[model samples]
Every structure is written in structure tokens, then in C-alpha cells.
Target: MREHPRDPRAAVIEERIASRPQGSWFTDPDPLKAEGDVRAVIDAARAQGAMPVLVTYAVHHRDCSGHSTGDLTAYHDWIEGFARGI
Candidate 1:
């Protein structure tokens, strides 16, 4: 991991694995699974007497430039779905 500074996923997985003693960990690989993932996290946090914070991701067309990007309508839809999830 020291040799892969730009690999955020690897860093997150490594941290999760190392923090096993602190709590159980879960990962959602599907980018389209945000709604369900957010709900799951919120439920888990509530169960532990914690408040959850959700940060949304890409809404428009992505992958063209190796980043999350989207147009106004797509982004608006994403935001709406996120709101529904909450």
C-alpha cells in the first residue's frame, strides 16, 4: 500500500481489514448500489447509536475521463434518489 498512494480503494480495504477488532466491515462494489448501501449504513449506524452522513457520488456520464461526471438531469435524478433513500 505504501507503494500505491493513488489507490484509494486499496487503502480503504487495508484500513478496514486492520480495524476488524473495532467493528465488522462491509463493502459495496457496485456504483449503482448507492441507495441500498446508504440505507444499510444508516441502519447500522442507528443500531450503534450513531448518526450517519451520506455523501453522493457521480450523477452524469462517467468513465470517459476516468472520473465521475454527469449532466444536469442525471445529476438531479441522482440527488432525488438520494433524498428518497434518506
Candidate 2:
């Protein structure tokens, strides 16, 4: 992990649902729809010499969706990494 510092080039992205932490069931595979799209996002970033600090999140629950304090906390860190990398 890299140390945090202020920079305009940085970016942060996050998704959260409010009981479980992020990626409680994060599969290794990317979402089907996201597969191609994410590559494109990465390609665009690379084309411009931008750093890609990628992180994915998933919340585990009885159903397909749920969240907890841990999820939000994870979201914060993921976004921070993304932003710092940028």
C-alpha cells in the first residue's frame, strides 16, 4: 500500500450498502456486464498514463444485497486507494 498524500490527480470511487463488510462474497471473476466495460475503463486510464488503482466490493447477506458499518469502512478505504493511485 502507498502512503496517503494530497494531489489533484487522485480519484476515489466506492459502492456501499448499509451489516456485512465489502467483498464478503467477492468472486474472483468480474461481473459479466462489467467485464468488458472495466477493461475499457482501464484502457482509457492507461492510454492517458493514469494509474489504475482498482478495487471491487460485494456485500454478503441472506439475499443478494445488504450492508453494515464494516461495509462502509471498507468502501472508504477502497475509494481512498483509488483516489490516491490516480
Candidate 3:
């Protein structure tokens, strides 16, 4: 576990598990689809009297394989566009 400077009382835990025989698949989000897609979900939830939560996952060096990755500046710009679309 490791602690972050921004949250002194909070700790982050990371663990690796053994691989299973069954295979797994992964899909990445399309930034182009994010605006309308996210807004549609948020609108639906609002109509149902539910609050929506947004989580930002794009970060520099994410996945360590150049997949689903974005730099900080790009992240901020994308988020701005997403908010505008909402």
C-alpha cells in the first residue's frame, strides 16, 4: 500500500493475482464517442431522479502499453469538451 500526498489519511493498495486458464478480453473507450454517449447516460439518470458520477481515467502513461492513454493537457482539453457537451 502507498499513500498519496493529496490525501494523507488515505492509502492505495495494489495486488497482482495469478492468471486463470480462461481468457479475458479488453476494450478501450473512444474519445470521439464520449461526449454524446456520456451525456445520454447522464440525462437518463437525471430523468430517473438519480445523480450521475463521472470518473476520469485518462492519464499520462496509462496501461503502460500506449493504450487508453492521454497526457495531462489533452486530458484537461477533452474534459472541457465533454463538459460543454453535457
Candidate 4:
């Protein structure tokens, strides 16, 4: 998994997970910082010879009546940023 700035366990979890010889899954949970985050994760994965899988979770009305709702414009920009990162 990618290291998220807001996740308290990000560093520890990433260190443990990154040691495995497997792909890394990155999620764009924060629109404001997702671009840089994605880029960093991709770079790190590539350095380790692992494929990076990006999981975009921000979308308009995501999760239906549950949490994770986002604005359409924001999602659009987020997606653009995500592509740029790749």
C-alpha cells in the first residue's frame, strides 16, 4: 500500500509491506495531495521493481449514501493529476 500523510501507521505499514516482492497498491484519498503522493509511490515501486496500482477513490457521490462523497470538478482535476503522475 502507498504511504498516506494522514495515516498514522503509514510509515510502519509501508516499511513492512514494501519488503515483500509484490506490487504496491496506491489510493488517491486526498485530492489536494494525491498527485505528489501518487508520483512518489510510483517512483518508489519502480525503484523496487514492483508494479504500482493506483486506486482512485474520489468521485462524485462515491459509496452511495455512505462516506467518500466528492465533487465532480474536484474528481476531474484529481484524475488529471493522477494521469500526470503516471
Candidate 5:
């Protein structure tokens, strides 16, 4: 049987990626829940000595293929809640 060799650089790259600050995506349909979740993420990031980066992807007709699609009015409300979280 042949032994498989692993690239030592892969571990270093993975560690670097894990050490970096990551952004959180808010895709919940419920505005209230999204608000609370965003706030929690922000708080957690702050506690970790990192700034929060958020991604809002709940807009109506997102991607134009029915993926993450929602009503415009609801999207507006969701954005409002997301803002409140910040």
C-alpha cells in the first residue's frame, strides 16, 4: 500500500483562514428574528475583538431565480430590523 502525503502548507492556510474575522449573513425571513440574530452576532464579534461584517441577502427576487426570494414590503421591514440591530 502506498502512503498518501498531505501538503503541510494546507494546514497553515486553514489556520490563517480560521484566524481571520468572518462576516455573517442574515437570511431569515422573520424581521424580528433577523434583528435579534444580527445583534447577537455583532455582540459576539465585538467580544472577540473583531468588527462585525454583515451580509443582507433577503431582498425580493434575490438572484432572479426564486432563491432567497421574498415580498418587497417584507424585505423593507427586514432591512429596517437589520439596521436596528447595528
Candidate 6:
């Protein structure tokens, strides 16, 4: 948000957040579940005058089980098909 955008990370993060599929749940991990941890991340990011981003991930036990969205094809297919056209 700084003038002229010295922080390129801001634009990238914002665009990613905006382009994400609707109703998608992209929150910080459990360690960052605490208010203090989240605040620390945001505060550190803000010090650089950049936007903050919340990224999500899954353990994907199904990968080993060959059930969950295990591979790139499966991931891309699901993302395109189910992901609200994001």
C-alpha cells in the first residue's frame, strides 16, 4: 500500500487473495492460530510496508493412500472444476 508500491509483495498477495476461489478457506496454520502469532506475522510484514497473506495447506494423507487429491493433475483438475472459477 505504500506509494508507488515499493512493496511488490503487496500486489502479489492481494491479487492472489482476490483471485482465490470463493468460500475457500485459506487461513494460517495451527501455530499461527493464536492471535499473538498472527499479529506478529502481520506486524512484521507491515514493517516492510507490504500486505499480509494467509496461506493454507493440508497433510494429504490421501496422497500416500492414493485417495486424496494426490497428484498435480488431480489438484489442477479439482481446482479448476470445483474452485468457483477463481
Cα RMSD, each candidate: 9.0, 15.2, 14.4, 7.6, 5.1, 13.1
Least accurate 10 contiguous residues by lDDT in model 5: 1-10
Give the number of the best model, judged by lDDT: 5
- lDDT scores of the candidates, listed in order: 0.58, 0.42, 0.53, 0.71, 0.82, 0.47
Q: Rank the candidates by TM-score, best first.
A: 5, 4, 1, 3, 2, 6
* Residue 23 error, candidate 1, Å: 15
How well does each candidate superpose onto the true structure, as a TM-score? 0.49, 0.32, 0.45, 0.60, 0.71, 0.28
Tell me the tens digit of each residue's lDDT in model 2 across 13-43.
2222322242212223224433444455567
Model 2: worst 10 consecutive residues (lDDT sum): 18-27
Give the clashing residue pairs of candidate 4, or none: none
Measured with C-alpha atoms, the lDDT of residue 7 in candidate 3 is 64
Across residues 1-86, which tens digit of lDDT does each residue of candidate 1 receive?
77887886997889788656443222222334555666677787789897665555454553578466546775666555555556
Clashing pairs in 2: 11-83, 19-67, 19-68, 23-58
Residue range 1-86, candidate 3, lDDT tens digits:
23455664333322122222222211224454556656776787679796665654544466767766666776666666566546
Give the winner by TM-score.
5
How many Å off is the CA of 56 in candidate 2? 0.2
In model 4, the Cα lDDT at residue 15 comes to 90
Instruction: Evaluate model 5: give its TM-score.
Output: 0.71
lDDT of 5: 0.82
Query: Candidate 4: minimum summed lDDT over ten consecutive residues — where?
Result: 23-32
Candidate 1 has an lDDT of 0.58
lDDT at residue 45 of model 2 (Cα atoms):
66
